[model samples]
Target: MLANPALNKLRQQIGCIEETQRRFSRTIPVTEPVDRWLPYGGLSTGCIHEVKGTNLASAIAFSAILASRLAGDQGNILYIAPDRSLYPLGLLSYGINLDQFLHVSTRKSQDLVWTAMEALRCPQVSSVIALLSGLDLTESRRLQLAAEASGVTGFFLGHAASAPIASPITRWKVSSVAGKPGQRFDKPLWTLDLLYCRGGRPGKWTLEWHSQALLPIVPQLPAKQAAREALAG
Candidate 1:
């Protein structure tokens, strides 16, 4: 018996698709707790993710950490925003390699999105952090596709809790959690809510950001407040 030509062609196509998926599905390693919680050990590259919160500082901090980790020492990372509000020095605490970091500030919102989409398509760019006020499903899908093409990780930092965009692989909502009275100078605390994960369950956690990793901390939320936030998430 001989193999049919059509069957051979179909096998070749399937092999190519599997190879593409394996290439794009490589994940950036994250710390414990969060790492164990994630279906994968860490976030998958070649995908768009969103971080939202009332306190932009906490959200931006988290995004910076992820971007820095994704870019490592040699890869490039682009930060796109309306203004030059994200100080490079501030990101130093997050272990960001300033030499590999670039910030592109645009006055118009549309320009910000356009710049991010272009950056995501750049093979030299390992990650892109875009501060977007709002993004519809269409725009989100475009960014997602761009990342897929270049195997770059993209982060969207949204100001408020906007309508959930469908294209992102995961959506996280963060908020500042007050620490002990005299521990203000200690590590800042934040409540991280995994609002929506494409392949995982939603949950909440208290995390303290250090120079190297995200360590789980004790929850500071009251039972009632925690319940409300959980429901909202």
Candidate 2:
């Protein structure tokens, strides 16, 4: 009898689960919490998410948060950067431990994409972050396939000025936002926008890295300011 592909995949997943359970000796949550703005609660396993930005720092900041969250207590993360060196200090500020992560540098964009796909296929790695200059439909599909095969999460970072719309499970755009000058560090403020999601609506929110926490900035006028305005009117 011919082996059923579905059954084969099920068996593979069961094996993976058993291996992970044995190594960790604990049950980890299946879904990691992203932003409430994200649809589907968080990114699903075996899926590809794209982050686009003109500012490299903004993109890295967003990806770092996802990586740290998915890494959990003992999970491992792999990062492929083709544009520049992965700054340990920046990642530390974002609450990611450089010592606990794998950083791979590639020469070309194509190599970066392929390496990311291969890393995702590795059973030992829980998440893969790929920094690519650009990607077409074919490349995106290939990465998606690898993600599915290994049940790994993939994050693709695209160029800041040019971001082609590829078919990813979720797509986010990060941009600089105005902040109070001289109020604190020289780091720029940023906003994260959910441009496209397979199972959620599109929305935008401001974000700030403060006191080692990635806090979402709620936009609202102060109550005292509103009251004073009302009295003046």
Candidate 3:
């Protein structure tokens, strides 16, 4: 006898639930040094994550890269926001595939929550990035549950507001910093703050999200052995 598709899906979801019940769930692998500071040394899945931007552009850029990395090979992204200024060419320049992104807009903020909730529950969807002004803790919790039930990740992107809202698995704040001036194609530097985490302490780091990798932006140092030659010159 053949197994029912619905039944098979339910079994898969059950397995996912078992994984989430553990102290550490699956995370997207990262190669940067900052990985150690993250909850599990990587981006945790099956939970609602918040990314607050100092400005919209940096937020979108930061979130887009993360969404792309999370989606991986076959998953698609559902992005909900009223702002339609998401430039396809720019995203392509940033190494995000244009075809994998689906943009949805809503006039009502309540509709935004509902749409995000539904998207989070779709197994095929890898990530949901919702740009909203405000969301009560109750609504946000529903989204978090949906994410776990579907084994997907959720990112709520918004401007910094007076927040006393739902506790996400992880909360981040990002702001753009000045990059090298004369280099026309220098990647943007960002100040990243770990505002909150489920079981980790909050901290900050400076990183540059290059198109190819997430690199910690560290200061360059002169080689000690070569310093004497520099002084003699």
Best by lDDT: 1
Clashing pairs in 3: none
In order of appearance, the predictions have TM-scores of 0.81, 0.73, 0.81
72 Cα displacement, candidate 3 (Å): 1.8
The per-residue C-alpha lDDT of model 2 at residue 73 equals 70
Q: List ranges where model 2 is wrong by over 4 Å.
A: 1-36, 181-183, 186-188, 221-233
Spell out the clash pairs found in candidate 1. Answer: none
lDDT of 2 by residue, 75-145 (tens): 77888886456677767766687766988897877787778878878867878888776678888888887
The digit string of per-residue lDDT tens for model 3 on 49-159 reads: 888888866777777788888887678988898768776677665557778989999878888888888899999999888886677877888888889888878888877
lDDT, candidate 2, residue 64? Answer: 76
Q: Where does candidate 3 stray beyond 4 Å?
A: 1-24, 162-164, 219-233
Candidate 1, 3-33: lDDT as tens digits: 8999899999999977855644578765677
Which has the higher lDDT value, candidate number 1 or candidate number 3?
A: 1
Scanning candidate 2 in windows of ten residues, the lowest lDDT window is 24-33
- After superposition, the stretches of candidate 1 with alpha carbons farther than 4 Å from their true spots are 1-24, 182-186, 220-233
* Decreasing lDDT order of the candidates: 1, 3, 2
TM-score of 1: 0.81
